[model samples]
Target: MKTASIAHRVVDFLRRWPPFQYFDDDELFSLVSAGRVVFHERDELVFMQGRQRKPYVYVIQQGAVRLEEQSEDGVDQLRDVRGEGDLLGIGRYLGFGEHVYTARTETDVILYALPAEAFWETVKRHARASRFLATYFSVAILPPALEMREERSEELRLGRRPVDWMSRPVEQPSRPLTCLPDTAARDVARLLAERDAAAAVVIDGQGAPRGVVTPRTLSDEVASGRQPPDTPAQALMRPVCAVAAPGLEAGDYLTRMLDQQTEHLVLTANGRLDGPFAGVITRRDLTRVEGAAPLALIEDMARAPRISELAALRVQAEGVLAAGLTDPDATRWLAPMAGAFNAAVLRRVVMLVEGALADQGLASPNLDHCWVFFGSAARNELFTRHDLDCGLIYDDPDPGHARGARAYFLELGRRVSAALAACGFVTSAKAISAGHPSACRSVGEWEVAFADWIHQPIESCVYRATSRFDLRPVHGDCRLVERLERHIHGEEDRNPRFVPLLLEDSMANLPPLTFFRGLVVDDEGGYREVLDLLRATLQPVVDIARALALDSGRQAPTTLDRLLVLQPEDDESSLLIEETAAAFRNALYHRARTGLTTGTDGSRVDPAKLTRLEQNLLKSGFRTVLRLMEYTGRRYGLTPRR
Candidate 1:
């Protein structure tokens, strides 16, 4: 009778906490039945650091526990403290195999020890419980030690309700309309029509998706006389992309769709091309997920009939940015989505300008071209409005037609640049813009210019040309952008001096830390004593990644992606790389959050306004920046110029 009473008390306490609150009565009772209550006196050690992980995780039934880690010099450092219903060991041993810190009682304490395996099993079976835990423990899964304070500003919470829903795993994927690779196009079309689906997946003999056929494919193939209705499904199909069904979240799926520029994504057992086909996520399915407002806004921007409408939509994007930063899971995917919003606006602006030009009897020059964005825009790292840094690249024209082609492109560039400026992305005189004659060029000219910059390796050329290396095509012939990429790589391969010089250049901007290793702020101008977030912290990481990427032949456009691509295998080196990536992400988030609050470019920040925790994070990040810069210098056998 006493044992039963103790179990009942433990179950009542567990029920009050989340994850447990999500469990039903039977599951809750079962979980509590297998758990035991333990007590410790003040200062008693609960678990020792570096010991094998225990099979159980503890819930604080009473009192408190503090987690401590011994530094290399044998000093104990407090990592965290847990009290009341707080859970312990979730982050430290998610898969770590050993306790990362020592847990000691802060007072006489009572803990309900739950079996880890049984708890995880319950979490997996209950989606809400799983998601709650996923968000609560995301720090382990993502870059660590970035504990930013949650924003409580009214502006940030405006659209917070919808994001809660968006973060859920995509509603169970719809049963995909499927066809064999050898199935006839007519049969595929019939399947799509009969199901009222817009697309059909072509599967292999093992049920893996090989291709997809959409209404567009049918129209372009059979209806346009390019092929008969009896043509094989494979012949009418396009290469398909699949995401694993397990652990798939709606917001993540939407981001994948935006990134891949696909209207549909096939679901598979393992999220690989060869994995067994499961189902599909289409545009309509995304619309059903309320968290897809950002995507819907982008689509609306694309079809917006006028620049005024696009400008209005641009204003709404700020709300999206604010809401994303306020949410934990959405924050991880914020950069890509912001970039999508920016690109969508730019594409819309270009289309509007082109249409206006046509009305004025100014048809674009008959040449293949691409409008490319530089720096953050190219890297898809944009969070808010930035000064437009762009250039135009087109196919080489006939000798006599060169001047005409350049003139036409320049006119288009000027108008588009002006349109973007009106739409909130102003063009700074110091930054590169497509309207500038030097940046508006044909393919051959662009090739020659890039080669000169590479072979020259002069400070002036490198300084002016750094942005060019980060270029990504936002519109037009992507092949032109690829040709430029190949040209740049080929030049680097031939000119070994180029990457080294670039590395040295990257090191020129020392981390903005004082002699005492504190954040350095501007001493003069309207923004005196304010830290330039971009220059002091963000740019060093960007520069290091760019130089390292070029040297390693990594062509990924973003700093984070570049870092991942070039990450070393050595444990020590890997930790430094990981820290550097985390620093960059933290700084970027801080800058964006600051920008949203201050209504500036997010470049300058007043450290005094930051929470103590945020200030500490910045200091830690700056230190990591210093370490990364030193690592880069050592790698290149060069020193930062005094």
Candidate 2:
């Protein structure tokens, strides 16, 4: 059978649609030919309820296909409609028995009928296509994305959420075994054996968690044989470090643990640690949150009505992520959450902004404009910061062609920028706003400008590349966005001038801390009276990771995730690299929390507020980040250019 010009258009349209977007042109045409086109009169049954549909899928070509449902509860409802190129009979092709919804032609219609064997054969060969059909077949599967979400929710309710990857308070520690500060090692050792326990909590006179003495700790001390066997248990005990309110997420658990610098967390009913130790949360608990975070957020995004609601919801999703950044396992959990939410938000932004722009005369003749997100968003790195880096690409650069489109793009950016601002992040002050001429350009102009940036590799050019690496289409033609990326990779993937210079810029991260001595802060110095958020942590890790990734042709959107993909396995160095990054995130979270608590933007951590154990952990983690930054600089030969 010969495919029509209309069939080719169907192919083109299907290729643009998702799941189908994953298929190539040749394969698409074959799919069109295997499918038969039929016309239906008004109010006729396209496929009856309980009908056995074996060899066809339908796409509403010229009119609409309405699916009416007769519920078991004795109510009739219009389930959904398939209009225009919307694919239908997916359940018929994919479902096993009787159809759940009855399909009827709403108006005079031309519908394409795809052969079941051919469609299934094509889908079976492609996993995304299989999932694509499976996903859209019903509203149910689309909600949580998987069964794992309910399990995660249950875990969160049980206080075993993502933060627990850093720690899990004992499900039930046997009846309290406490020892006085002055208890002997011999007595403590004997008591441990008698109680059939490896450790015992050491409390002050007031019965507060002062420290803990474990067999490993005790044995290590005993190995020295310096202290008498009768030495006080407190003498060998590690001081209490991180403490949190009971029933927190695993991510929070890991973060607080990382911040306080201890694996053992003292849990309290309230924030105050005056009560008995509720339990301990070890780093083993973060794993559950990873599988759960992405699913939970996706479900929540589906339920959320307004963008404002989603903004807060997105913020809530970060609770575990903040914690995951502390423990080694936490980042793993954070990665998928970051990627999924980032993708979800980008998708929703396109829908919302497109609707808003349509109201403002965008696409008056089916718009040729594309709204793109660059920098972190494009590359799948979504931080809480307002990274308002975006651009608009239209089909023509002949100023007159985009006059209405330009105004639409400006209004589009303003609305999106405002939406993002209301959602927590502060927008950019400079004209990176889509309304600005510098950011919004016609497709030809954008291409020319991009080419110039790639070739020049100047200071301004460096900034552009650094900021624009993550350019993704939030709205309009994503093919246009992909083309832009291909052009970038082809031109600047390993450009010596650009890569080397990026390395140099990244090298100017936090100053290496003294190994023997600690970092010093001068009275009026940048680090003075505050934890240098930029220098004390995140900047060094992010900047160096980005540089290393770019230099190595990894071409990632962000620092941490790129590093993970680049070196998925853990060795001495990669472990150090990962842990160092976690430390940076830990510091940032701590600063943010501190700032939030004190109602001050300055992330001031009072050394006195932290227990000795926490101070030590913070010091060790901070030092690790500093060392990693220096190591990357040395490894990459990032010498200061004269």
Candidate 3:
């Protein structure tokens, strides 16, 4: 009877917080039954950083605990303060082998010691509980109230539709079709037919994957008479693309395939090329996953023949974006997939334009070139249609045909831009476009232009030239783009004053926040009480990322990608950087969601329309932006003006 009373008290405490709040009564009671109450005095250490794994985790019944870690200077730096109902030693529950930070009581505290083994066992049956823990642990630091509200929002959104299968763990094939490297091509084909498999994995004697064989191989090689029917499978095999099966979701599989530009992924015991093969995931397999809206759109855009048809398909991309915004878990992968759809449309646009030019009897000045995107499109973060910023770069011509080559490309660039405009990607007002003769230039000319911007450091010229640094080649020869990047970096190395001037230029637009940390709203625009999300918040973050990328010589194109490469000078700076990344994501999501719902460009958002939780989050995000500005000022030795 006494034991039952203790269990009841424990259950009451555990059910008040996540991830335990996500669990049902039976699961909660089971977890609480294995826990016992413990006490700690003020200033007593609960756990030490880098210590071996503990058998149990703690939940605070009352009082607070301070989490800190030793710095390089051998001083303890506080990271977080966990209050009542907060979970401690979460690393053990998450499979972390050692403590990452030392936890010490700030006041006399009562903790419920929950056995890690029992907790794990209880959570395994509760999928929602497990997911909550996963997401909660992934972030740096968030207030408990905000975290709980966000999870509740996620629950409501996720319940409105079927879960995205792409985010689920990919299943290992029970019987993957395999063949020896020495097997005949015809025999490999026959085996695939017998098993009704899409492709066959070529394996060596030790059961390690070597490569893959598809029907396309037969149609291109054996049937085309390039190779005989008796040719060895190894001779016709493409390099094997393999990934580990354990802990990898289907979205992860898709990302790897996109990175390697391959169609097939072989699942193995480990994520090594030489590891034992487990199964295969093909493009065809991905097509079958429900909620593959983005993948389907990309495929449709590739097959679209006319500018009008491509425009219609682009509208479907908005639908995909709308569905993704509602589900927070899926939004993380949405940007890249949406970018892929846009890239396909652009590639088709180029093809159609070239064909049209050929029909007009315009002939033969085929110089190697690359078509690149600038601004948000280049960063792979475009969720809504915005003004297009693009440029064209071609190889230099010989002295004799320079004039003709220039004329041919100029005409081609204008047609490409016109086609894109027809397809709803209207050119930017700044006129930094492929259609303009200034933006269409030879590789040598582009180098000279970039060099001028670096050495001269004029504010207006640098402002006009900033988009070029975010260059991402979507079509044509990539070598030209490579040459340009190398030249830009080399020029920065030579001109020491260039980067600081660039930093100053980036800091030109201050974060829109008042002295009391309130948002600065538009007073002159048609949308009263509305905040311009892009100008007020997102652009400042983008500017900082671009300047840092140029200064560090890191070629990564996206804001998040740039942050990944940056190493903060101190622990405080590191925490701020992490928080800044999170804030940027939240702000971007709000903008995208607003645009899709209101049919506007998504640059402006009315704060009064936001939920109470969103308003709070936005305020928190503004504080983060403010802190970031101070950090930047200190790092660059420049005062940031409000």
Q: Please name the candidate that would achieve the greatest TM-score relative to the true structure.
A: 3
Off by over 4 Å in 1: 1-174, 180-198, 202-251, 260-263, 267-278, 283-290, 327-331, 514-528
Residue pair clashes in candidate 1: 244-271
RMSD of each: 10.9, 28.6, 10.8
Q: On residues 196-280, what C-alpha lDDT tens digit does candidate 1 reach at each position?
A: 9968888888988888899889988898989988999998889874465645777777777766556677788887878988888
lDDT of 3 by residue, 278-370 (tens): 888877777766544555566667778789999999888777667656643455676666566667777888889888889999994878999
Which lDDT values do the candidates have, in the order given?
Answer: 0.76, 0.58, 0.73
Measured with C-alpha atoms, the lDDT of residue 580 in candidate 2 is 65
Return model 3's CA RMSD, one decimal. 10.8
> Which regions in candidate 3 have their CA more than 4 angstroms from the true location?
1-140, 143-167, 174-184, 201-212, 217-247, 256-263, 266-279, 287-291, 327-329, 514-528
Stretches of model 2 off by over 4 angstroms after superposition: 1-160, 163-331, 335-339, 342-346, 360-400, 428-432, 459-461, 472-476, 512-527, 555-557, 565-585, 588-615, 621-636, 640-642
Worst 10 residues of 3 by lDDT: 516-525
Please give, for residues 172-232, the per-residue lDDT of candidate 2 as tens digits.
3435466898999988888878876645778887767778787777777875787789899
Ranking by TM-score: 3, 1, 2
Whole-structure CA lDDT of model 1: 0.76
